[model samples]
Target chain A: MAKTITQEFTKGLWDEIPPFRLVLGLCPVLAVTKSVENGLGMGVAVVFVLVCSNMLVSLLRNIIPSKVRIACFIVIIATFVIVVELLMQAYAYPLFLKLGIFIPLIVVNCVVLGRAEAFAYKNGPVRSIVDGFGIGIGFTISLTALGALREVFGSGTFFGMSVFGPSFQPFTFMVEAPGAFVCLGLMLSLMNLAGNK
Target chain B: MVDNNMVDTNKFIVSHAPFWHDGSKISTRNYNIALAALPAILLGIIFYGMPAVGVISLSISSAIIWEFVFRRVTKRSNTIGDGSAAIIGMLFGMLLPATAPWWLVILGTFVAVVIGKQIYGGIGANPFNPVVVAIAILMISWKDLFDFNEALMNYDFDFAMVYPLAALKHFGVSAVDSFNAGDLLMGKQSGGIGSTFGLGLIAGGIYLIIRGIIRWEIALSFLAGVFITALIFNMTDSARYAGPVIHLFAGYTLIGAFFLATEDSSSPVNFIPMLIYGVGAGFLTVLIRNIGVYVDGVIFAILIMNLTSPLLDKIKPKAIGKAA
Candidate 1:
C-alpha cells in the first residue's frame, strides 16, 4: 500500500503529468504562463486543489452514488475551488490578479475532475493525496518550463530577470498567443520523443 | 487497412457499393457556418448602426473578390461556390471596429482569404485561423490602423461609450479611473465593430450552440478561463483592471470564442482536446488583454490556438475500444 501511494504520487510528475504527459489543466498552463512566476503560482494553486480534492473524494468515494456521482462530485470539487479562490484573494493578491479567472476556472480544468473520476474514486485516501501531489508537481514543472522558455525568448527575461546582452532584442511574437502555441507544440513533441525513448 | 490512394482511384471510377461510395460534391458545411454568422451580423448593425453594415459588406466583398482573383492567378479551379472565402470575410469583418478604414478592411479580407486561407490550398488546408492571421499581419505592419484611441477620440454625444482600450489609452497604462464598466457591457463602448453588444453577442452564441454548429464545452471553458482570471484580477485591484463582465463584452470575446475560434477547419475534432483548445484560447485572450499593452486578445488568442490544433488532434484519446 505504501509503495502504491508513492508510485501514484510520482506518476503525475512525468508519466502522467497534468500538462506534458496527461495533457490536463491546459487552460492555465497556456494562458498565464507568460512568466515563470505566473506559471509557478498557477502550478502551486492547481497542486493544492488537486491534493485537497483527491483526498476528499477518496474519503467519500463509497458514500457517493454512482447514479448521480458526477453532479455530487461537481459540488465537492466546486467547494474546493471556492476555497482556493478565497485563499488566493486573501494571501497572494498580486499573483491572484495575474492568474485571474483561471483560479475558479480550475473547476472546469478537466485535470482535477479527470483525476477525481480516474484515481481518487477508486483509491484510498493516502494514495489519492499522493497522486494529486505528483500530478500537481508535474503540471507545475511543465508550465514553468514552457513559461521560462517563452519569457526568455519573447521578452529577453528569465523569471522576470533580464538575461540577454544589451544587443539582444526580444521576439515580441514569443510573448503573444502565437508564441505560446509554438512553444507548447515544441515542448509536447520534445516530451513525446523523450517518453518514447 | 484500405489503401487511401486505391480508394481515391476507385471513387473516380464510381464504386457502386455503398461501403465504398465517394463523391466530389463541394461540402456545404462552410456555407452553413456563414449562415450561422447572420445573427452576429444583425447584432452588429443594430448596436453600432450603419457603419457596422459598411464594414461587414466591404470585408465580405473583398474576400469573395480576392478568392476569384487568387484562383485565376494560381491557375487553380475556381472555388467561389464553396463559401469558405465568404465565411472568412464575414469572420474577419466581425473582428474589426466599425470605424476601421474601408481600404484596410479590404486589405484584411485579402490577407485572410488570399494569404491565410487560399495560400495553404484554400479553406480546410489552411494551418492558421484566417481572421487572426490577417489581424496579426495588419497589426504588425500597420500599427496606426489598430490604434483605437484615434478612432474613438471624437466622443460623440450618442457614441460616448468608452471602449476598454480607448479608456486605457486615454488614461495611460497606470490609471484605471477612466474606465466605465457599463459602457463595456452595453455595447456603447468603442472597440471592434462586432465584438461589442454583450446581450446581442450572447444571443448569437446561443444560436450557434442550438444549431449544433458548436459545442458548449469549448465555448464555456473559454469563457470560464477568461472570466475567472479577470474576476481574480478585479478583486485584487479593481482600480487598474475591469471586471469579468467588462472583459467578456468589451471586444470580440463573444464572437471569437463562439464563431471565430470555433472554426471547424482551424480547430481540433476530438472532444477532450477540443475543450483544451477552447480553454487555451480563452486563457490566452485574458492573459493578453490584462498584461499586454493592447486592448484586444481574441485575434492573438485564436491564432496561437490555431497553431496547436494539429498537436491537439494528435493527442486525442483513442476511443475506448480502438487500438492505440
Candidate 2:
C-alpha cells in the first residue's frame, strides 16, 4: 500500500507531467511563460491549487453527488484560485502584475480540474495530495526550462540579469513567439528523445 | 482542363506516383493558396515602392532556381511545376523589407527553397513550414536587417545603400520615433515589402478563407493569442510594451499568421491540434516581442508548431476500449 502511494506521488513529476507529458495546463504554459520568474510563480500557484483541491476532493469523494461532482469540484478550485490571486496582489505585486489575467484564468486550467475528476475523487486524501505535488512540480520544471531558454537566447538575460558580455548582441527573435516555438520544440524533442531511453 | 502538353502523361503519373502511392495527397486548395497571395504581391508594389518590386521578383525567381537545383542535386523528379515553390518565393519576397538588398532577398529564397522546403525530401516531407524556417534563419544570422524600425529610418524612401538596423542600433530609440503606427498602417513606413499594407494582408487573408484555401481557426487563434498576451502586458505596464492592437496590426503578423503559418503541410489536420498550434504560436509571438530580442515571432511560432504536428495528432479523442 505504501509502495502504491509512493508511485502516485512520484508519477506526475516525470512519468505523467501535466504539461510536457499529458499536455494539460497549456494556457499558462504559453501565456505567463515569457521569463523564468513568471513560470516559477505560476508553477507554485498551480501546485497550491492542485494540492488543496486534490486533498479536499479526496476527503469528500463519497459525499459529492456524481451528477454534479464536476460542478462541486470547480467551486472548490475557484475558491483556491481567488485566494492565490489575493496573496499575489498583496505580497508578490510585481509577479502579480506580470502574471496579470493568467492568475484569474487558472480557474480553468485543465490540470487542476483533470486531477480533481480523474485522480482526486477516486483516491484517498493522502494519495491525492501526493499526486498533486508530483504533477505540479513536473509542470514547474518544464515551464522554467522553456522560460529560461527563451529569456537567455532572445534577450541575452536570465531572470533579468544580463549574462552576455558587453559586445554580445541579442538574437531578439529568441524572446518573440517564433523563438518560443523553436526553443519549446527543441526542448520537447530533446525531452521525448531522453524519455525514449 | 488536364493538358497533355503540360507533361508527358506517363512522366506526370510516375513522378507524382510517390506522393499518391505513399498516401500523401495534394489538394486543389494549394493552388488557391497561390491565388490568395495575389493581393499581397500587388501591395508589395505599392509599399516600399519599386525596390519592393525588385525583391519580390528576385525571391520568386530564386526560389524557382533553387527548387530546380535542389531536385537535381537530390536526383528527385522536379516538382516546381505544382506552383508551390513559386508561392513560397512570392510569400518570402513579400515578407522581406522593400529596402533589402537583392542578394539578401536571393539568399532568403535559397534558404526557403533549398534548406527549408526541399532539404527534407521536398514539399510535404518537411517537418516545419519552409517560409518560417527561412525567415528564422535570416532573423538570427542577419539580425540587423530584420529590424523594421531601423530599416525605415535608414531608407526613408531612398533604397540606395540602406542598411536599416544599423541606423536604429546606432542612433538609439530616437531613430524609431520617425515611423509611427499611422505610417506603418498606410505603407509609408519602412517594413517588409508587402506586409507594410496591413489592410491588404488582412483582405487577402479573408479572401483565402472565403475561397477555402485556408481555415479560420489557426489564423484567429494566432491573432487571439498575441492579442490576449499583449493586452495583459500592456495593461500592466503600458509605457513599456505596445498595446494588443498595435501588436496585432504591426509588422508582417497578419500575413505570416494567415498565409504562411496556416500552410497545410506544416499545420495539424485535426481541429483541436490546429487550435492549440495557433494559440501556441500567438503566445510565443507575444512573449518573444516583449522579452525577446526580435520584433517578429510569427515564423518561429509556426515552425515550432509544425515540428509538433505529429505529436499533437497523436492525442486523438479517446477510442472506446481497444485493449487493456
Candidate 3:
C-alpha cells in the first residue's frame, strides 16, 4: 500500500492540492491571494515551513512520545514558521510587510500540522520531505492561480501590470472579501469537475 | 372488472395531497411577471430611447443563452423553457441605467444566471434573488454606472436631471426639491431604466398582487414599513430627511417591495414572518438611505433580510401530530 517516491511527490500536485483538493490552509489562500506577488510570496514561505517542519517531525518521530505528538508537531512547525518569517523579513521585506501577521500565522496552518500528524509522523524523513515539497508546490500553484484570476479581472492587471487597455473597467468586486469567497468557491467547484473527469 | 385495455390513470395518480394543479405552470408565472413589468420598461424606453431597448433585449437573450449553455455543459435537463432565466434577466435589466455598456449587461446576466441561479441549483433553489445578487455585485464593481446624474446627463427633460437619492445623499435634502411627488409619480425622476415609473410599477405590483403571483402581505407591509419609518425620520428633522411619499416613490423602493422582496424562494411562507421580513427590510432600507454610505439602500436591505428568511420561515403553523 506504500506509494512510490514519485507518487508521493505527485499526489500533492493534483490529488491533494491544498486549497482545492484538501481544502486546507484557506486563511492565506483567501487573504494573501489579492495579488500574484502576495500569493507567490506566501506560497514560498509555506513551502519552506511545510518542508522544514515535515523533515524535522519525521526525524523526531521515534523520540517524540505519542501522547504529546501534536504539541511536539506544533513546536517543530512553529520553529520553522519563525525561520520563514525571519528569512522573508531579511530578503523580502516588502512581501513580509504585505503578508504581515499571515507569515507567522503559517505556524498554525492546518496544512502543516495535518501533514506532520498524518504523514511525517508515520513516514521516513526522505518521504516526508518529498511529501511536504509536493504539497507545498500544489499549494503554491493554487494560490498563484487564484491570485492571477482575481488580479487580472479585479484590477485589470496581472502582477501589477495592466492586462487591458485604459478603457477597460475593472470588475472591482473580485478584489473585495465577498469576491474572495466567490472566487474560492468557483475554483473549488472547477477542481471538483476536473477531478471527476 | 380489470380490463387489460383500461389505462388505470387514477391508480397511478394516487400521490401526495393537492393533486389538483389549478392549471398553473412555472412558465405561466414567469411570463406573467415579465408581462407585468412591460409598462415600466415601455416608459423607460420612451424616456431613454433605443439604448433602453438594447440593454433589455440583450440582457434577456444573454441570460437565456447562459442558462442554456450551462445546462448543456452540465448535462442537466434543459430548463431554459421555464422562463426563470428570462425573468432574472428582465429584472436585472430593469435595475440598470439605460446607458449601461453592452459588456456590463452580458456580465450581469452571466452573474445572475450562472453564479446566482444555476450555481445555487437554479431558479427557486437560489437562496437570494438572482437579479438582486447580480445588481448588487454590479453596483459594487461599477458604482459610477448606476450614478443616474452622470449616466443620464445628456438627456434633456423639462424637469431636473438629478437622481433624488443621490441628490439627497450628496447635497442634502434641499437639492432634491425639484423632484416633487407629481414629477416622481409621472416617471420624470432620473434613475434606473424600469424603476423610475412609479405609476407603472404600482399598477404592475397591484396586478401581480390581485393575480396572486406575489404575496400581498409582503408588498403592502414593506410599503407601510417604508412609509412609517420615513415619516418618523422626516418628523425628527424635516430639514434633513425626505418625506415618506418621496421615499416610497424613489430609487428601488417600489420595485423592490413588489418584485425583489417578494421573490418566492428567498421569502418566508408563513404570514407573520412575511410581515416581519417585509417591515425589517423596509426599516433597513430607510435606515441605510438616511445614514449608510450607499445612495439607494433597497437592494442591500432586501438582501440583508433575505439572509434571515429561512429562520423567519420557522414561524409556521404547527402540524397535527402525535408528538409536539
TM-scores, in order shown?
A: 0.55, 0.54, 0.95
| Best of the candidates, DockQ | 3
Q: Which stretches of candidate 2 lie over 4 Å from their true place?
A: A1-197, B1-30, B154-185, B319-324
lDDT of 2 by residue, B1-324 (tens): 233212334456322211112122243555666676677668668645677778888888889888888677555677777777888888888788767777677777877887676755566656777888888777776666777666556454533232222333345434444555555555554567777666767777898777656768889888898889989987997666666765676666778778877886677766788788888888887787677655566677777778887788765566588763
Question: Could you give candidate 3's per-residue lDDT for residues A40-146 as a string of tens digits?
Answer: 99889889999999999999999999999988999888888899888888998998999999999998899999999999999999999999999999999999999
Fnat computed for model 1: 0.00
| Model 1, position B98: C-alpha lDDT score | 72
Give per-residue CA lDDT, model 3, range B208-299, as digits (tens): 98888898999999999999999999999999999898899999998999999999778887899999999999999999999999999999
TM-score of chain A of 1: 0.94
How is the predicted docking of candidate 2 categorized under the CAPRI scheme?
incorrect
> Model 3 residue A88 lDDT?
85
Judging by lDDT against the true structure, name the best candidate.
Answer: 3
lDDT of 1 by residue, B145-169 (tens): 5666566455464655565654653
Report clash pairs, candidate 3: none
| Per-model TM-score (chain A alone) | 0.94, 0.95, 0.98
lDDT of each: 0.75, 0.75, 0.89
What is the full ranking by TM-score, best candidate first? Answer: 3, 1, 2
How well does candidate 1 score on lDDT at residue B259? 77
- Candidate 2: residue B170 Cα off by (Å): 11
